[model samples]
Target: MNGRFVRLGETGRARVAIVIDGQAVDALEGDTLITAMLCSVRHVRQSEFGEEKRAGYCLMGACQDCWVWTDEGERLRACTTVVEPGMRILTTQPEAQWATLAL
Candidate 1:
């Protein structure tokens, strides 16, 4: 499930390190946050309700299914935000730390 979406004969884009939960993942330039995440991970976040893993439902920003947090705790919609180099991201809200710890 972790792979790049390369068009036939297309050259690779510049790689950037996008950190998720303190781990680094390679992402291509011009990739949205969700696209970059999808290249390395399966889910965008865990649901607060039941700790269910959630991926993006809407590629656009209208749906709230693809929200991710900055390391500083600010939330952003992953499908609309472009990935940047050295971005420290957290895949779930800080409140969801308990679910992660339980894993």
Candidate 2:
């Protein structure tokens, strides 16, 4: 588990489980997707253009840097999305279709 942000004497906050890259991670009920990842995930996504890594920037969802994907090929901004129970998320870009690949 990654480091937590809990304050001393804090208690009774509900937890919601979200699957990131096939791994289950716990997030507080009121947490935004970025906040959920910040509580446990070390990195959010890999840059598609290069090998650089990404976490999050502009917590208000203006930068568009913290996007994650779902199994159904839908993408959502992590910074503004809220955590929901049994939600499946993928930090990496989904596999490209064979027809989309160059010969």
Candidate 3:
């Protein structure tokens, strides 16, 4: 185990399970689903057009690249959100709609 895992605090990380591309995964404690998704592959971000080099921009929930599909059918930004138990995350494709439009 990495030193970090051994020293997790009250804010300690816990292993949360999430589904990636239909496969179940146990992420690091306190680790976001996006981190878990990234472990499977270098770039977790995806576009409907299936671009391979997509990446998250403002991990603070300001950018659109980290968007992912949750099991509940809602799309959300990944970086600012933490992973929960039983979360099914599909880190693929672009959203059908953008809440805000920029010209």
Candidate 4:
């Protein structure tokens, strides 16, 4: 799928591998998680309150709009967290995994 954000410049950075949901995505070496996510996906994450998707309100770490989780249930501030090679990100809350299992 096409992403919401397009890269107009800085195309020379090394690519890093990361998994979003279950799909493999390429991110820049020094990019923040939010930047990496928006580069390959339409939205940053699904809203916990409803079905609406979110793409982050604040680019900095001051807001809670960019919260995402790891496979291990660790919360991350996508806008402030740097993307790392082999990073596995879940746009949905990790607790949802348990909810699914319980169903």
Best by lDDT: 4
Regions of model 1 farther than 4 Å from truth:
1-11, 98-103
Candidate with better TM-score, 2 vs 4: 4
Model 2 TM-score is 0.82
What are the clashing pairs of model 3? 9-12, 13-29, 13-30, 14-29, 14-30, 48-94
Scored by TM-score, the top model is 4
- For model 4, which pairs clash? none
Residues 7-72, model 2: lDDT tens digits? 343336898888987889888887888888877777778777777778877889899899888867
Q: Which has the higher TM-score value, candidate number 3 or candidate number 4? A: 4
| TM-score for each of the candidates | 0.82, 0.82, 0.63, 0.95
Q: Which sequence of candidate numbers ranks them by lDDT, best first?
A: 4, 1, 2, 3
C-alpha RMSD (angstroms) for model 2: 3.4
Candidate 4 matches the true fold with a TM-score of: 0.95
Give the candidates in order of TM-score, highest first. 4, 1, 2, 3
| lDDT of candidate 1 over 1-103, digit per residue (tens) | 3634433432378888889878778887888998888778778888867869888897898889988999777898999999989999887787677566889
Q: Judged by TM-score relative to the true structure, which candidate is superior, 1 or 2?
A: 1
Tens digit per residue, CA lDDT, model 3, 1-103: 1111222344445667777657776677777655556655455556766456555665566666787777566787777678778887666542433322332
Residue 93 lDDT in model 1? 85
